[model samples]
Target: MRWGTFTSSNSVLLLIDHQVGTMKLIQNIPFETAKRNTLALTKAAKILGMPIILTTGTENGFQGPLLPEFKELVPEAYDARIARSGVVNTWEDPEFRAAVEKTQRSHLIMAGVTTDVCLYSPALSAVEDGYPVQAVLDASGSPTELSEQLARQRMERGGVTLTATNTLIAELARDWSRPEGSELLKLMVDDVLPPVF
Candidate 1:
C-alpha cells in the first residue's frame, strides 16, 4: 500500500507518552509548539472520524497525565486513553495492544514525547506486526536534537514513514472540497499556519 494513501477508516492515531513531565523535557522543539502540533493531530483525527488510542507510561509517578489541552481535544467516549504503570513500549502493554486491535486499522499514525523511548518502541513494533506506521515528526519530542534525529532515522530504517503533522492532516483530508477540509484548515490556522499580516 502507498504510505500516502490513508483513509480514516483504515488508519488509527496513536499518541504515546505525551505526559506533562516528558513534554516539558523536550529540548529539540519548544514545548508549546510540540503541544500545538499534537493538538492539531488530535483535532484532525477527531474531525476525520479516526479511531484514537492515547497511552502514557505512568500517570501518578514521573510521567504525569496527558497534557490537559490534549485531553480536552479528545472526547472521552470517542477515544481510548490508557495509562500503564511500567511499560516503556506502549505496544507491549496489553491494554494498548487491545485498543489498537479494536480499531482494526492497517495503518497507524503515531507521535509521542521522548521520541527514542515512547515513540520509537511502538512504531517499530507495529511495523514488525505488519502495520504500516507513520510517525509525525513535529508532534514528537526528545531530550536532545541529535537523539530526536537518530530516533527518526532508526524508525525510517525500520520501514516506518516519517512525516509532519500537517502532511498527515492533508493526506487524511485528501481534498480541500470536503467539509472536513475546512475544519482541518481551521486547525492549521490555530496550530500551524502563519499569522495574517
Candidate 2:
C-alpha cells in the first residue's frame, strides 16, 4: 500500500471479534500482548479520529463484550458493533457492510481475534470486492506463531496490505510538524514506540 497516500483519504479501521472469549484462544501473541496491542491500535484510531468499526460474534453466550480499554477509548464505537449468528467472514454480515458504508471510505484497516478465521476472511472478500485493504497484523493473532505467519502469507498473496500499528500511526502523522504531533508522540511513547526504544 502507498502508506500515506492511500491511508490519508479513504481509510477506515475495522476491529473484528476482539472480545474476551475469542482472545483467550490466541496463542501467537499471548492473551496479554493481544489485549495490549489491540488497545494500542484502538487508542491510535481514536486519537487519529479515523473511522473505526468494531464487531462481535455471539457475544451473549459468554464471548463477552469487547475489551474494557477499547470500550473506554471509543465508546462511540458501540453503534458499530456488528452482532452476527455465524458469519465467519465478517464482511459477509450485513451489519458489517452497513458500518463500513457509514465510514464513507473505501480503504480498510482490519484486525480480528483469530488470525486465520476472523482476520483472513474479510480481507480476502474485501480485496475481491476491489477495495484496498490493510490488515493490521500485530493486532490479530492465532493459536500458534506458525499459523499466524501462514495466515499473514495468505492475506499477503490475496493483495491485502499487512502492517503494524506503529506504521499506521506514523503514516497517519504524515509529518511530525502537523497538529497531531503531541498526540502522536504520546501514542508512540505510551503505546507504539516504547517497546522498540
Candidate 3:
C-alpha cells in the first residue's frame, strides 16, 4: 500500500476498549507502558485538534468502563464515547462506524485493548472499507506474546499500517518549533517516555 503522511487534519484517533478490566488483560507489554502510550496519543490528538472517537465493548460486563483519566483529559470525547453492549469488533457497531464516518477523515489512528480481538478485527474492517489505518501497537496489547504477534501480522497483511506512539506524535507534529509540536514534545517527555538514568 502506498502511504500518505498523517496530518492532524487528515487523521482521526480511534481509542477502543481501553477499559479497566480489558486493560488488565494486556500482558505483551507492561500495563503502565500501554496506559501511558494510550494517554500520550490522547493528549497529542487534543493538542493537534484532531478528532478522537473513544469506544468500549460490553462495559457493563467484564470489559468495564473506560479509564477515568480519559474523562479528565478529553472530556468531550469521553462524554460522547460509544459504549458497545456486545460488539466485539467496533467497526461492526453502527454507532462506532458512524462516528468514524462523521469525522470524514481518511486516515485512522487506532489503539485498543487485546490486540488480537479489539484492535485486529476493526482495523482490518476499516482497511477493507478503503480507509488507511495506523494501528498504534504500543498503546494496544494482547494477553500473550503469540496473540500479539499474530494480530500484528494479520493487520499488516490486511494493509493496516502499524506505528508506535512516539512515531505517530512526531508524524502529526511535523515540526518541533510549532506550538502544537512543542506541547506534544512536553507530553512525550512527561508522559510517554521512560526516564533516562
Candidate 4:
C-alpha cells in the first residue's frame, strides 16, 4: 500500500459503536484510557473542522446508546448519527455508508469499541470498497489481547492504516504553531497525555 497524508479537508472521522455497553467489552486496554483517547480524537477533529460521522449498533438492545460525550462535543454529528438496527458491519448499513459518502471526504479516520468486531469488520469493508482508512487503535480495543492482535493483523493486511490518537492528531495538525494545531496540542495535553513531571 502506498503511504499518504490525511488532512482535515480530505478526511472524515467515523466513530463506530462507541456505545456504553459495547465499551465495557474492551479488555485489551484500560477502559478509561480508551475512552479518553476516543474523546480526545473527537475534540481534535472538531477543532480542525473535519466532518464527523457517528454510528451505533442495535442501541435498543445490548449495545446501548453511543457515549453521551460525543453528543456534547460534536452535537450535529451525534444528532445525525446512524442508528443501525442489527447491522454488525457498519459499512453494510446503507444509512451509515451514505452518510460517509455524503461527507465527500476520501480518507476515513475511524475508531470503535471492541476492536475485533465493531471495528474490524467495517474497516475491512471500507478498505475493500476503495476508501483509504486509518484505524485509531488506542481509541479502540478488543475483548482480549489475542483478539486485538489478530484483528490488527487482519486490518493491516486488508489495507487499513493502523494509527494511534496522538499520531493522527499530529499528522492532521502538521504544524504546532498554527492556532488549530495549538488547540489540538492542548487537547493532547489535557486528555491524551500524562503529566510531564
Q: Rate the local accuracy (lDDT) of all candidates.
A: 0.85, 0.80, 0.94, 0.92
Name the regions of candidate 4 deviating beyond 4 angstroms.
none
- The best-first sequence of candidates by lDDT reads 3, 4, 1, 2
Per lDDT, the best of the predicted structures is 3
User: Please, what are the lDDT tens digits per residue for candidate 1 over residues 1-197?
Assistant: 45557778799999888888889889998888888888888889889988888887778877787888765677672245787888888888998898889877888999989897789989999999988999998899899989998999999999999989888888888777879988888788777765797
Give the least accurate 10-residue stretch of model 4, judged by summed lDDT.
1-10
| Steric clash pairs (candidate 4) | 115-141
Question: Residue-wise lDDT of candidate 3 within 48-87, one digit each (tens)?
Answer: 9999999988878888999999999999999999989888
TM-score of 2: 0.91
TM-score of each: 0.94, 0.91, 0.98, 0.98
Find the candidate with the highest TM-score and give its number: 3
**What clash pairs does model 3 have?**
none
Error in Å for residue 47 of model 3: 0.5
Residue range 99-130, candidate 2, lDDT tens digits: 89877987888889898889998998999988
lDDT for predicted candidate 4 compared with the true structure: 0.92
lDDT of 4 by residue, 1-197 (tens): 87478999999999999999999999989999999999999998899999989998888888899999987899899999999888888899999988999989999999988899889899999889888999999999999999999999999999999999999999999999999989998998989887898
- Residue 11 in model 3: lDDT: 96
Higher-lDDT candidate among 1 and 3?
3
Model 2 CA lDDT for position 73: 79
Q: Which regions of candidate 2 deviate over 4 angstroms?
A: 1-4, 195-197
| lDDT of candidate model 3 versus the reference | 0.94
